[model samples]
Target: MLAVLEKVSFLLKMKVAQGFQTQIAGFYIYLGLMPSWSTRGL
Candidate 1:
């Protein structure tokens, strides 16, 4: 039971980390595109 719980926790942590990384990447991409968007009046 302990081993199963640990495995589940690890998987959950990995998923959370991946989601955080994706969010960070998206934020940077948005920031990088902002200048061009403003220039184009979008």
Candidate 2:
């Protein structure tokens, strides 16, 4: 039971970390893309 709980906790932490990384990557992509979009708009 303890092992299972530990596994669940580890997986949850991994998922949260993955989510944060994905958000940061997405933010950078948006930042990277926006300049081109604005340039096109002009």
Candidate 2 local lDDT, 1-42, one digit each (tens): 999999999999999999999999998898787878686775
Task: Give lDDT for model 1.
Answer: 0.91
Runs of candidate 1 exceeding 4 Å displacement: 36-42
Q: State the lDDT of candidate 1 residue by residue for 1-42, as single tens digits.
A: 999999999999999999999999998898787887585774
Spell out the clash pairs found in candidate 1: none
Query: What's the count of clashing pairs in each model shown?
Result: 0, 0
TM values, all candidates: 0.82, 0.76
Report lDDT (CA) for all predictions: 0.91, 0.91
In model 1, the Cα lDDT at residue 10 comes to 100
